[model samples]
Target: MTPPTGTPRPAQAAEAPARGSRLRKATALGLAAGLAATGIALSTEMTAGAAAQGSLPAGTQLYKDPNSQVVRWVAAHPGDSRQPIIARRIASQPQAVWFSNYSPSTVTNDVKAVTTAAAAGGQVPVLAVYEIPNRDCGGASAGGAPDLASYDAWVRNFAAGLGSGQSIVILEPDSIALTTCLSAQQQSDRFASLSRAGAAIHAAAPHAKVYMDGGHSAWNSAPEQASRLRTAGILTSADGLFTNVSNFNTTANEVNFAKNVLAALGNPGNLHAVVDTSRNGNGPAGGGAWCDPSGRAIGAYPTTNTGDPAIDAFLWVKPPGEADGCAGPAGTFLPDVAYALASAGASDPTTPPPTTAPPTTTPPTTAPPTTAPPTTAPPTTAPPTTAPPTGAACSVSYKIASAWSGGFTTDVTVRNTGSAAVNGWSLKWAFPGDQQITSAWNAKTTQSGANVTATDLGYNAAVPVGGSTGFGFQGTGSNTASPTAFTLNGTVCTVS
Candidate 1:
């Protein structure tokens, strides 16, 4: 299904054609949830016993694939300018190795090679099994097993490689969530295969943890997703669900969305969630441009250290710098994007290096725009308006995602710190130096004088108490200083 925002879902591209193909040619295969309200907590009562069944055991050392695309690229270009940061930040991190090709003859051995190495090191390896029939709904990352029966057999071979040690499986991303092109019978058959796929894996590798897709928060509603998971046999088949696979939603929103989904599923004791923290540090590009829109950074490092019990781990399911099929062929690792993500995401507090995988998530290092004169400068900064005493207050974060000569782009996040949910919002801010907004997204935004006003679009109107919504814009002129003040629905907000 199309996301609520009608944005394109990020593509988890198919893996490389073979395991060692990248070492010779330096290529690899690669691959959102959201929260609704602010401070929404999962019902501990519902997930009380999940701790015992959720996540790989604490202190589990996640396996870092030595042959990942970044690793090979780093080795191949040791003296390149971007090599140092890419090696230190991304190549060293532990990311899932996708077995996306339908190579039945060698599939078992390929899976075994990875799991066995992890077992030798007493670490748990992550495997993304993406060969579902009609995967990606025939989109850019399309082509999987030709039929469901073939998929089931391939899955069994995949399970054979899991050894006796603990392993994690991100089973068939976009399989359950992106079924719009399938007929009812096609969906049923696919779901049945998924159910059997889980069973076959567990039967072969009892120590493996298999997670199905939960879609992201910006996509399906909790109840709707829960119903889909149920029909897919999530309750009895899989260990948990995964979110933000290749998307760029914030970690906070994914956590909130996962909890709500679990709550709707009646909080099964064995069901938890893992989120993809590969490229979401700066959140979405806004306006649903998921096809490798520029200016994204990496998110939280992969780890099981998430303090919340309902969340199993924050994983690097999508390899950083791998094109989302837009910037390059889906799985090719581009150094420019890799370097961009590393340099930019390095300073982010939410994105730390992983204990086992060095560190992958980094804050964007792109400088905010430098101050410059506008073509049509305004006379003066607008005076602040009186805030209505509706118990609605907010905090705003204004960030310059990228900048260039005479133009720049920004993302503005508005968080509700009020007692009540904001049904709708209008945010107003005055430019310190007449920075003119040429275009805007995710809201009806316009500028008059040095003042800019942005109101919510219908789908994203509500900002639940403690929840946030964001919008972005492309603008002309540059300004180092953020707007001195911001008013949300006429109530002044805490600016940062």
Candidate 2:
């Protein structure tokens, strides 16, 4: 795998938009309100300004991808203190803006600001419908939508702000699978709200595609989740089901599990999936906990160029820098930790944080090698039917709510939502309208015509079941329109 060459964040000026643009949305979701392609869109101004900000960037794919043995080696041996920033630089991907931790009104403005910026930058923005009732399902990060009416209203407001096009929405976490945690009545209420939310988004922004959460592979099996989605009116109301948001499952496992879920959903032509590549570099292991787990680097960001049929693009839905509960509080931001994460390439921290000090303070010979086991697994349910094969005509029949930073990276992430492993994988696409590939990671990439593709190597072949690998890279560009169409393994991952 190649190493990343992306630079560090530059000092910011006042966050403002030029001519005819809306003032920057001061909401937590605000920034360019403009998201990026490959689903890794973020607001640098938001992240930089906050005492503790949590957001992934456009080329987060490259920053998060662990495609570099060189960077990995340097990271593994942080010999001196300078390595943290070096690690951050080494881990650098295209950055994004954020707007989390805002009040309802602020969220509205945040969304609007980012959207405006995205339009100005011509980049697509990544929107997460996190305000669901009992959102965390009472888990550690357990806090979300308090009521259906309010939840629906929030989604409605969010939907209303979709500026023109080039936006991706990852709606609700633990909304579907955690149904078991709630009463039948409660589940019904939330699903009804989600159904309404999906419909509203589609209606308000027909150009914007909204995806429902499918949980992670560890939580729900495809068929089971499919049943939940069907009940939630996924087939009829939303674009398709989403998996691995805010969790650390591998892309391979997510791919297989998603394919199974789609199969259970009658494999509708309007179905597809998005994998959360914010983390999961080594794939989830050592019991499923999402707290900046050990050995977890970044996974693939958004991409229309995946080599699968059933999957659309792998996205960084869970804003990377945010804490996954367990640490301090859920969704809260911690900059020192962020700096540490940036430095060590922030793979999952399997054991708890060191009590006394960082490993560097202690003697190297005394320190334990800090690698954690993986946490990959198959879908929780048995497939009712055989899953789709690798590169086969994917049954993806949904519009991709995507984010992109132009082209491929060395350290990339790919999942096999289809039944079989991709015999070989190559993501290729031409720049749409004003967009272009700025950088890539985790894999070698090449561009011809408008077509650009990233090819995986032996170490990163056929994403293992429910497993995700992150790669990194660097490039140059300016345009920012989310790719509308993509082909996985030659077959198109299209909206029905």
Candidate maximizing TM-score: 1
- Over 1-496, each residue of candidate 2 has an lDDT whose tens digit, in order, gives 0001111211100110010000011111111111111112123422221111112222322222222222344456555543444344323442223222214554555567656766665556665555566544444433444567766666666776775665666666556766545665566666666767777776666656567877667765566667667656676566676777666677898888888888878877766776766556657634343444434556664454567667766775554444443222333333322333344343423223323234453212111111111111212332222333654543222222222355221222344455555544555456565433332323445566567765543324345444344333333345444445655556564422
Question: What is the Å distance of residue 286 in model 1 from its true position?
Answer: 1.9
Please report, as a residue range, the 10-residue window in candidate 1 with the lowest summed lDDT. Answer: 17-26
Each candidate structure's count of clashing pairs: 17, 102
Q: How does each model score on TM-score?
A: 0.63, 0.52
What Cα-based lDDT does every candidate model obtain? 0.68, 0.47
Root-mean-square deviation of candidate 2: 23.1
Tens-digit lDDT string for candidate 1 (138-210)? 6556677888888888888888878778999988777776766777667667776787787777767777898
- The parts of candidate 1 lying over 4 Å away from their true place are 1-54, 346-496
Query: Candidate 2: where is the Cα deviation over 4 Å?
Result: 1-102, 332-496
